[model samples]
Target: MSILYLVKKNDELISHCKCEESLVGDPGQLDCPWCGCGWLFSCTKCRKAFTFAEAKEIDKTWEELAREDLLGYSGKEPELEDINSWIDCMQNMVSHIEAGKTYIYLDGCFIPADEENFEFEGWKSKHNFYKTPQVIALKDKDIIDEVLSNPQYWEENIIQEQ
Candidate 1:
């Protein structure tokens, strides 16, 4: 019950160990049994070693199995959903808000709240990685001037106003 490793370059091609000799001894070992080669990861033709990130692992035992890259945020945060809902509420309020009324922008979200007393009330609040969101009045003259002058802000979802 030995597991064979292979690299598929294309639909028609598959590569195996270039040791040219049959794997010797027991199935589970760090080094290739036949050649006593510890570097099973070395490229056969080019002889270059691959880092873990560059190489793909295939389990021949389960040929149909799929691989997934589990990186970045999965959006499972409950607080994020609530925050988004609050953002939506604020977006809806924008149309009815008074012409001179001010709004607070906090960490990519806009809400009609007192900037000085505003806090993101959630489990994320206590985490050190989560910085206390800087409060900025969306109607500030300086902010308006900067946003108008800067092209970078135009490309980002800075203001998700409907």
Candidate 2:
């Protein structure tokens, strides 16, 4: 089914794509099948669009092309549940977003250790994409700053505090 992709324009409404060709989902923009109103995602690059499910599948396909990044010293490596838990606890997933990087786009490889050695950087991922969303590509810029500002949430769950 086709879905409508809308973006909030300074508290206004803007439709990216009509819900006719691409797929769409519910309100939050999460991938939910059988949603009342389908929601689609527009490519920040070609301005192409896709339904929630379709975008997800596309993500899956490009996952390999995605660079591997160490989300953090999640004690050692990153765990889906732990990361997801942090995202839930913080209510924002792209905490330490990098410019031109899509935290959601990249598939996290959990380390499961406790700390990064000299061999590891704080995080690791691909260089950059030739074509993608500019905003989504750029780090939330303040994501890491925001996380640092909020100690309770970051330490309590995300980082295995020493």
TM-score of each: 0.17, 0.17
The most accurate candidate by TM-score is: 1
Question: For each candidate, how many residue pairs have backbone atoms clashing (under 3 Å)?
Answer: 0, 20
- Against the correct fold, how does model 1 do in TM-score? 0.17
Candidate 1 residue lDDT tens string, 1-162 = 323222322211112434332111111112111121221223323332221111123333221111010011122333544445533443342333333333322222333333344444221111111221212212343532343223343334233334
Candidate 2 clash figure, as a count: 20
Candidate 1 pairs with clashing backbones: none
Over 1-162, each residue of candidate 2 has an lDDT whose tens digit, in order, gives: 321122212211224544343222112222221121111233332233332221122222111111111121122454565545533432232233222221122112111112122122111212222322222213443532333223442233332325
| C-alpha positional error of residue 95 in candidate 2 after TM-score superposition, expressed in Å | 1.3
